[model samples]
Target: MNAIEVNVKNGYKVIVDNGIFDKIPEYALTLADYTTVTIVSDSNVAPLYIERLKKGFLRANKRVLTYVIEAGEQSKNLSNYAAILSFLANNDFKRKDLLVALGGGVVGDLTGFVASTYHRGVDFIQVPTTLLAGIDSSVGGKTAVDIKEGKNLVGAFYQPKGVFFDIETLNTLPEKEMINGFGELVKYGILMGGTLWKNLLSDNLSLENCIADSIRYKAEIVEKDEFDNGVRALLNLGHTLAHSVENLSGYTVPHGLAVGYGIRRIAKACKNNGLLQNSEYEQIINVLDKFSLTYIAPFSDNALIRASVKDKKAFADSINIIVINAIGNCSIQKFKLDKLGEFFND
Candidate 1:
């Protein structure tokens, strides 16, 4: 069992272990013994994990309920957010009760937002199923839904009381789902300088260590800048391009794949500006290619450029993007929004 403790507003423990799903009820007791649990899941995951989770809570004699939503990026919007809020309201969930986010990133974010807002705040736990969620979104307090304008436009930095990572579920994951987490996982390698980058290049990097390194990097960032007023932005290394590609593709593409393509684009920009060396840039591409993450956007160069302007990171004059200064370290560069055109298909 690998357990990481995060120090935030509502500090939480992220437990990563094999077959932790069966232990959900066991951990819930450690959070709050006598609270109601509303497990928020999506269509894709509900059929797989819901009954097991429900049974876990029931065994502990805790009153349990579930709220299911369609599984997709589109589902993380105002309509579903409102629906979840209504579910809790109608059920009379108190602030002392618990909201268990029981799926991947989308489910976690939407449920966390609902927990944060409903009754001014309620206790919530994260049980992220996807590799993407397990490595990134599940540990962080960040939660939000997308709008027509952009991704994560409406959300909050609301911490969960606990996060449980059930690695056994990964055995059931589709190939694309594995790539989704790998997309975000690569960012940690870029942000910190050390053996992490070197280890990532080798064929022997275990799945558990990959997730752990990513969480450790993210946990430290969130601790210092929980509100995202500073260093936390470093975590968004390839995200600016990520949002644009997803927007241009109409979100038909998976976020992890889009992030891979976005990271490719950002690497090009870094190489052009001399921030990254020729060999280092090629090595980054090699790693991505090895992971089967080489993707090209179907959108035109101009279209991608235009889509980037709508990102939340874009200010009236500039947008914040992470540039690779070396293999293991990345730095945020604020460039004129119009100059974002520099990153288009090259």
Candidate 2:
């Protein structure tokens, strides 16, 4: 096991390894200082590992409560958010209590949002099951639920007390979920490049090392800009378009898959605009192909542009877009919102 410490205002460690799900209670006890724990999971995950998690807390002499939301991106909404908040309140969960997000990104995001808002703030930890959560959302502290207007438009930057990534749990995931995760891994590969990028191009990518490397890169950025006012937005390399696509599709598109489509569109746009080299553009497309992430968005360029204007990154008349200068190198560019159609049309 490896504990990668994220140094922020309320810093915490990201623990990664096989079978580390068994160690979650121990980490929670050490980090959260809670009397009770609410393990928030989704329908897909509850039947698989909820009992083991419950038993662990019970053995630690702690009270454990479980809440299972219907599994899907649509569940990450104000309705479920309100329901979980009411659940915590009715159960008399207090500030000292802990929340354990025990599924993938949706569970982690919704739970973290609840933990952040319940009583103004409480402690929470992430035990990410899917590869996408383990590498991305589980560690970022960017908690959010979707609103009618946009994905993750309403939320907080509340940090978790700890993050436990158990690779063993990933065995239960469907092939589609694994493909979803590979989308984010491809994003990381493009962002950080070098061996991480090189390793992802191969069939034998190491999950353990890849997770650690991705988290380490994210940790460095989060430490520098925890509130995401600056450089940290680079992490949204393909997310701007991803979120827009998701919102346009009414979130039926899985986040990682939407991200895959978004990355391709942005890469093509960058190449057309003479920002990314043709070789690097082809490399990104090839990588997406290797991972089966080449699904084109059903929406047109104009529709995507309209949806993107409402993204959280939009302000006044311009929006921040992460543009690739090359693989392993990118920058946040402020594009006039009206020109987005032109940019994408290119």
Residue-level lDDT tens digits of model 1 in 180-246: 7778877777776566677778888777877777787888988999998988999888887788888
Question: Using TM-score as the measure, which candidate wins?
Answer: 1
Quote the lDDT for 254 in model 1: 80
C-alpha TM-scores of all predictions: 0.94, 0.93
Quote the lDDT for 80 in model 1.
97
Give the lDDT of residue 86 in candidate 2. Answer: 94
What's model 2's overall lDDT?
0.89
lDDT (0-100) at residue 200 of candidate 2?
78
State the displacement of the C-alpha of residue 149, model 1, in Å, after optimal TM-score superposition: 3.9
Tens digits of per-residue lDDT for model 2 on 1-346?
7789999988889989988776679778987567889999999999999999999899999999999999988899999999999999999999889999999999999999999899999999899999899999998699999887666878999999889888899899999999999888998989999888888777897878888889988899999999888999898889888988887887688777899998998999999998999998999999999888977788888778778877767798999999999988989999988888888775
Candidate RMSDs in Å, in order, are 1.8, 2.0
What stretches of model 1 exceed 4 Å from their correct place? 338-346
